[model samples]
Target: MKSRRFMQPLTSPIHFHTAMIEQTPVAVFLGQEMIGSGKIVQITDYIVKIGNEFYVRDACTFKYAV
Candidate 1:
């Protein structure tokens, strides 16, 4: 006799991204206006730093491709 195993189609990271995008609509609210919308990279209890990996990807996108 042998035991069976199951594999999940969606991984944890996928679920996390789905939740982040669906549950919370990203936006910066200013009075009655919405300013911005984007993905969240990091979060903290007391404080958080703001930034994006655009610079990093820009540096590597075609550095050695050409």
Candidate 2:
């Protein structure tokens, strides 16, 4: 019989960076599904404000709209 081992997940804060400016159109995604699309209104260290909705910085993915 083989034994299984599980490793603890890292709890350190993640640093996110973006070059997109405010008012730029973007598509927000959680996992692989697109959740919303809007222009970026504000950005902070922990979250991003898009069209009155705030999403966690590390929890969602952003794709710039052309």
Candidate 3:
């Protein structure tokens, strides 16, 4: 049997960078499915704040500049 160890994010969210600014509306995706769209307000190491909610980068599938 193999032992499983807990792992954390490779990098800190503080280092995350976003080329866009707050309120820059963008489409959200989860794989081929379009989840929805929201104005980008914040960017963390792993998550993005859209409108007033936050979403994980790994979850979103696609984003189109709008």
Candidate 4:
């Protein structure tokens, strides 16, 4: 018989990078609500998503900026 182990996420919500359009509001969903109705801002920050599961990077490993 073989055994396997499953890893868990460090956080409940996951964040990712987003792009900004010209004179357009950012479109994203939080739970069931939509964010950014009529605000135009630079897309320098990352987009966060909530999920049941997530993955965490190792501390010993080096992370590259995408």
Which number leads on lDDT? Answer: 2
Q: What RMSD, rounded to one decimal, does every model reach? A: 16.7, 11.6, 11.8, 14.7
Compared with the true structure, what per-residue lDDT tens digits does model 1 show for residues 1-66? 321211111123443255345543233333444333344354333221123522221111111000
lDDT of 2 by residue, 29-63 (tens): 88888787777667777777778999887898776
C-alpha TM-score for every candidate: 0.29, 0.64, 0.57, 0.26
lDDT of 4 by residue, 1-66 (tens): 321211111122121222123232223333444332332232222322222212122211111111
TM-score of 1: 0.29
Model 1: which ten-residue window has the lowest total lDDT?
57-66
For candidate 2, which ten residues in a row score worst on lDDT?
2-11
Ranking by lDDT: 2, 3, 1, 4
Clashes per candidate (backbone, < 3 Å): 0, 0, 2, 0
Sort the predicted structures by TM-score, highest score first: 2, 3, 1, 4
List pairs with backbone clashes in candidate 2. Answer: none
**Model 1 score (lDDT):** 0.30
Which residue pairs show collisions in model 3?
13-45, 29-61
| Over 4 Å off, model 4 | 1-21, 45-66
Q: How many steric clashes does model 1 contain?
A: 0
Best by TM-score: 2
